[model samples]
Target: MKNVLFIAVFLCSSFLRAQEGTNMKRVIVPPEIVKLAFEKEYPGKTPVWSEEYVGDDNDEIRYEAKYDVNKTTKALAIYDNLGNLKAYEMQISLSQLPPKAQSYLKKNYPAKAIKEIAVVVDDKNKTTYEVGIEKDSRFYDVVFDKNGGFDVIIEKN
Candidate 1:
């Protein structure tokens, strides 16, 4: 169930008529609106930004910002053209993941190394964690609910 939205959003974000690719170009200063919004929402935090123009027209551009929320937590925030905060992804340590998610990993992929644990925050602030790991030269992303319930598994060749 969650896989559908995850795949759909990823597909929509990856492809757009105006963009040949979803390359993230680093910018010293983001758009004025994006700067203002980020400042207002997250004061005192330094931000590094990257932007990609999505969709088919001028109105469809999107701006993304990456910054360190703490020494151990990295944040990736996406803003709309108007600078409205759309969503953000937070990278957390394996120990920070839900207990069930951790246990599942230990039992199922004990021999494989755990990579990254990322929490996706949607517009309404709903969150999901995606754990990235590689095995046998193939990468897999396993997502879980906040309570550590299994969600979806995606393989990358």
Candidate 2:
């Protein structure tokens, strides 16, 4: 079960990353509704938007907005075609992570410098933590549950 979940998350993140790469070459304007929703929800913020197609036929569309919450904090918001928020993530300091998560990283990845840490909230309001680490020029996301228990590690391909 754990493996399955890990694979699923990996595939989804990979797809999004792939889509992002593709988007960089060509500008894709988001739907008006999506833009309006974002404006209403986060007034006075401009974001770089990208689209991701999902579902069996890849007909369902999702938009991702990347922006800075402040000079030091980066944030991302994912919304459906109708503009409903699917998930939100924001960068945080290492000290912002749960104590157990910090200890786990210290013990398991000794001497490794963390690249980024984010707190993600899904549509269902479930919270998770993702810690980015690099090894041998490769990047990986080590995810932990709300309570800081180890969840899964997703490697970027």
Tens digit per residue, CA lDDT, model 1, 74-123 = 77777877898876777778888899998998888854456666777767
Q: Provide the lowest-lDDT 10-residue window in model 1.
A: 11-20
Q: Assess candidate 2 and give its TM-score to the true structure.
A: 0.81
Provide the lDDT at 52 for model 2: 68
Residue-level lDDT tens digits of model 2 in 53-122: 6555767677877777788777777788888887777778889999999999998885555776788777
Task: Give the runs in model 2 whose Cα sits over 4 Å from its true position.
Answer: 1-26
Please report, in order, the local distance difference test score of every candidate based on alpha carbons.
0.68, 0.72
Q: State how far residue 150 of model 1 sits from its true place (Å).
A: 1.1
